[model samples]
Target: MSVRCLLPLVIVAIVAVSGANFKRREFKIKIDGEVSFKATPPLSSGKTITWKFKDLQGGVIRVMDFDYDESATPQNPLFKNCASADKKTGELTLHNLTENHSGLYFFELNGKEQMEKFPLKVMRVVQKPEITNEKTTSNPDVVYLKCKYDKVVDKDAKISWSCSNDTTEELAYTKTGKTDLCCACTLKNDVSQETSDQICESDLFHEGSNIALTVVLILLFILLFVVIVLVLMYRFNNKFHDYVFKKYEKTTCLGGMLKNLDQCRSGKKTGVKQTDVTTVYTEVNKIEENNKEDDPLTDPQHDYEEPQSGDKQTDVENGTPLKKEDNTPTEHSDDL
Candidate 1:
C-alpha cells in the first residue's frame, strides 16, 4: 500500500481502541454499610451483566441484571448506565432493566439482612440570595426593614442589607433552624431625605422565598383631626346658645316697658267729662247727703222758713198794719 493509505488505516485503528476504552470505564459508587451487593463489571455492546448480593454468612440472597448500550449515548440522554446511593450521582444503568427492576435490593443472613436502595436523584442548581423589600412609609425617619424566608434548610444561609444609593459595606446575617426566620433593622439614624432609594435584601439557599410588611399611619392622623374639629364645634355651639338667650331676655324687658307707656298715654288722652263720669260724681254727693241726714247734731235748722203778716191790726199797731203790705219781702231766701 501507498504511505497515505497506510496512514489512514493506523488512525482508524487508534480511534476504535479509544472508543472501547471509554465504554469500559468502571462506575464509581459509595454504599451504606447496612447493605451488601456485588459490583458488576462493565459490559460491551449488546451484552448483559448480573449483580448479586450476599449476606454476612456468605450466602447468595439477591440478584439484578443490567444491559450495556446498544446504540451510541446521546448528548442529553434521559437514562445512563450508572447506579449510586445519592441523588447527586449519575443515572443508573438499565439497558434491559424495566420498571420491575427499580426497587431496593435486600439480603437476609441468619434472620438478619442488609438493604440497598438504588437510583439516586439529580437535583437542579437553584438561584440563591432571593431578595425582597417590605412596604414602608415615605417618612424615612419612622421606617424599618424586615427580612424573612419561606423555608428552612441545613445549609448555611446568609442575608445582606444595604442602602441603594450608598456603596457602603452591606449588613450581613446568619441563621439555622426548623422554623421561618425574620429580622428587623431600624432606619431612624441611617436614613435621610436624600436616601429615598433605600432598600433591604435577603440571601437564602432555596428559590421562591420572600418577605412583606405594611405601614398605615395616615389613618391615625385623620382620626385626630376629626376629633379636634368636633371639639371646636361643640364649644362654638355652646357660646352661641348663651348669646341667643341674652338677646331674648333684653327683648322681653323692652316689650314690658313699652306696654306701661301706652297705658299712661291712653289715660291722658281721655278727659273725665263723659256721662259715666258725671253719674259717678252724682252718686258720691247723694252718699254724702245721706250721711249728713243720719247725724241730727250736725244740722239744727234743717226745715225753717220766714212768715208773712197782713194789714188788719188795731189803731195801736196802725203804723205796723199800714206797712204790712210792704212788710212782706219781695225777694225769697237762697235756702229754699
Candidate 2:
C-alpha cells in the first residue's frame, strides 16, 4: 500500500483506540436521591479535574475543580444544589438530586488525559398520594373524591388511582410535569363500608389539610385578641391603671400626725366643751378678830392692809386701841 492509503488507516486506528480509552458509567437512582462520584486513584501533582453535565435538552453545564485553592467559587446553577468534592483525591459528591439532574456526566482529568462518562437515570416513585377531598356532593346520590401527588417527569413512572382494589373498571388520570396532580371522580352515595374514610387514609394519610387550617385560624384569632387588649390598655390609660387609689391607699407614711389626721377626717374623735372652774382663796395665819379695830368686817381699811413680814402676832389687849365712834370704856372680854 502507498503512504496515503496507510495514513488513513493510522488515523482510523488512533480514533478507535482513543474512543476505547474513555470510561463509561451507568447510575440509576430514585428521584430526590443523593449520589457521590469518587476518583479511583488520587490525582497527581499539578493535575486538576473538571466535571460536565449534558441534559436531555442538549444543555451543557461545567463545574470547577474540587480544590478551592484553584478558584474560590464557580458560577453554575447545579453547583448550588450539589455537594462539595474531595480536596486531596478530587472526588465529587452530589446531594438532593431531582429528576432534572438526570443526564450524561463527564469527568475530565488533566484537561485531556482521560474522560470518564456517566449515564445517570433518576426514577421517581409515588410518595403516598394525598386524598384532597372525599365527601358527598350536592347530589344526594352522587359523591365526589379527589387526590393529589408529586409531579412525575419521566414516561416510565406510572401514576394511577383505584377503588377497593378492583380492576373491573379503571379510573381516569391526567399526567403533567409542571405541578402536582389533582384528580377527582364522582361515585354513588351508597359506597361499601370497606372503602370508607379509613381505607382512604391508607391510600393517602400523610396530611390533614382541614385540621391544620383550623388550628392556624385559632392561633391567629388568639393573637389578634391579645393585640387588641394591649392597644386598649395603652389608649385608655386613666380608665385602667395599675394603682387604684379608690380601692386602696396609694401611699402611707409612719407618723402620729398622720394618724391623728386620719382619725379627724374619719369622724372618730370624741367631743367635749371647755368650761372654767371656781377657785377659793384662804388666809392661813389670820384669826377671827372680835375687836372693832382689827375685825376685817368692821373696818374696810383693815382688810386691804398686808400682814407683818415676820411670824409675829399682837394680842388684842396689848395692842394700841383705836378710837371708837362713842367713847366707851374698853371691856376686857374673857372670850378674847
Candidate 3:
C-alpha cells in the first residue's frame, strides 16, 4: 500500500498513545450534507458542552458552545450559520458541509476537553461510468466490453463491469448465447459509488449488421465520388469546346484577311489594264444592225402599223428624225 493508505493508521496509533481513553471515529460525507456528533455522558442541567475544530494545518478554532441552564453561544464565525448544538442531548450538528470543513473535531465538557475525537472527510458523489463494445476476438460468437470513467474524482476509486457472467474486470469478454445478455458499468470510491445504465450485449455486438452498414456507406461514398468527377469532366468539356470554336473562328478570319492582302499585293505587282469604251460601243452597234436585218417589218408578208399623230408630233418637237427607207442620211452638227 502507499503512504497515503497507511497515513490514517499512523495517525490513529499516535492518537491512541497520546490519549489512552480517546475514542476516535472517521466519517465520510458528501458535499452539502449534515453530520451530528454526540458527547459521551450527555450534558446535565448545569453542565457545559463545547465543540472545536482542528483544521488540516493543525490550527484549532472554537465552533459552538452550549450550557444547559444558561445559553447556546456560537464562536467560530465560519460555522456561525451552519453549526448548532443541543443543550439537553449534548449533540453538535453541522449543516452544509464542504471540503474546507474536513478535519478533526473536539468536544469539551465544562472546562476540560473530552477524549473522543471525530475526523471528518467531505467528498463529492461518484459519477456514472461509460461502457463501450470492443472488437477483440475473431470469432463472431464472442463479445468484448470495456468500462471506463475518464473523469474520476476520487483517487481510491475502482472501475468494474457487471455482466451476465459476473465480471469484475474493466475489460471483459464473454460468449454470445441464444438468450439476451445485459451489462452495466460501475465506479466506486470510499465515499460513494455510481452504476451506469444497462446495455444489451447482443445489440451492441451485431457484427453482421455492422458489416452490411459499412459496405453500404462505402458504396454510397464511391457513387458520390463518381458523380462529382463526371460533373467536373462535363464542365471542362464544355469549356474546351467553346475554346476550340473561338480559336477556329479567329483562324478563319485571319486566313480570309491574309488572302485579301495577298490579292492586293499581286494587283500592285501586275499593273491594272483598262478596256476602251469606243470598242464596246462599236460591238453594241454591230449587234443592233444584225437585229434590224432580221426585223419582221422588212419582210414583204409583214404588215406595219402607221405612227399615231401624237407620237409624230412629240418626235418632231424633240428634233428626232422619222424613219423612211428612201430618206438620205443627215449631216452632224458641231454641238453633237
Candidate 4:
C-alpha cells in the first residue's frame, strides 16, 4: 500500500477507537440544587481534566480545567464559585443552578478531546399551588375546584388534586357532599413538587342561608295571593246581593214584598196559594121624628126627643158608632 493509503487507514482506526470511548448522559435539577457527573474510565496519575459547556444555541464555552491533585479553576464567570471537581475520580459538580445553565457538558482527558457528553436541564422549583372554589349554579351541592400556580417555571409541570375521597390528575375537580371533606392541590415537575393548604367543603356552600331566603319568599307570595282572592270574593258577594234584590222588586207588589220580607225574616216559606172572591155592601138607616098630631104622641112607640142644632153627634162606620166632637148621646139603626 502507498504511504497516503496507509495514513488514511490509521486515521480511520483512531476515529473508531475514540467513538468506543464516548458516552452520553442526562440529568435534571432544580434551581439551587446540586448535581455531579462522573468521568468514564476513571482518570490515572498525571492526567488533566477539562470540562466545557455547549448552549442550546450551539455556542460553546470552557467551564474549568484541573489535574488529579490540583483544584479546578473555572474559566466562565457563570461557574466561578459554583463549580467544583474531585481529584480522585475526576468528577465535576455544579451548584446554584439556573435556567441559563441548561446545556450540554463535555469533558476532555489528558488534553485529548472526548465526545463524552452530559445533557443537563436546570428547572425552577415547583411553587405551592393555589386552590379556588366555585359552586355549581344548577346544583348547589356540587362544587368545582381549580388548582393553579401563578408563576409556572417549567412547561412540563403537572397539577394534581388530593381529597378525602380520591386523587385526581386533573387541574379542575368536582366535589360532592355536605360532609367536612377536605382537599389539597399539588404542583409537580421532574425536579421538585409542592402542595397547597387544605380546604374544606363547608367553606364553599351555605345551605342554611339559601334555604331560609327561599322559604321567606314563598311565604310572602302565598300571603299576597290569599289577600287578593279575599278582596275579589267580597266585591262579587256585594254585587250579587244587589242584583237579586232588584229582580225581586220588579215582580212583586209593595204589600206582597213586605209580606214576603216578613215571612223570610221569620224563617217561613213565602209561597202563597191564589184565590178568587167577590164582596158587596148595602146600608139602611132608621130615623125618628116628632109627631105633629097629638094623637100619635099618646102611643109609647111614637114617643121621641128632638135633637138640638148645637149638640154634638156620632158617626157610624160598619155598625160601630164613634163620637164626633165630645161625649154626647145619639142613636141610629142601620142595615147593610
Candidate of highest lDDT = 3
- Steric overlap count per candidate: 4, 0, 0, 0
lDDT of 4: 0.70
How many pairs of residues collide in model 1?
Answer: 4
After TM-score superposition, the amount by which residue 318's alpha carbon in candidate 4 deviates from its true location, in angstroms, is 80
The clash tally of candidate 3 reads 0
User: What TM-score does candidate 1 reach?
Assistant: 0.19
Each candidate structure's TM-score, on Cα atoms with residue i matched to residue i, is 0.19, 0.34, 0.51, 0.51
Model 1: residue 31 alpha-carbon error in angstroms: 17
lDDT of 3 by residue, 1-336 (tens): 999999999999987776654433678888899999888889898788888999999999989787887657675677978888888888888899988899999889888998788889888878777776766547765556666665546555676667644445445566565337677878787678989887775576676578899999999999999977754453346564334434543476854543344344335556633433234546988999777777877656556777775564335567776654445545664447
Instruction: Report the poorest 10 consecutive residues by lDDT, candidate 2.
Output: 275-284
Residue-level error in angstroms, candidate 1, position 49: 2.1
lDDT per model, in order? 0.37, 0.52, 0.72, 0.70
Cα lDDT of model 2 by residue, 212-315, tens digit: 88999999999999977854553345444222322333345423332333344234323422211111101211333336567677887874756554535555
Please estimate how well model 1 matches the true structure, expressed as its whole-model Cα lDDT: 0.37
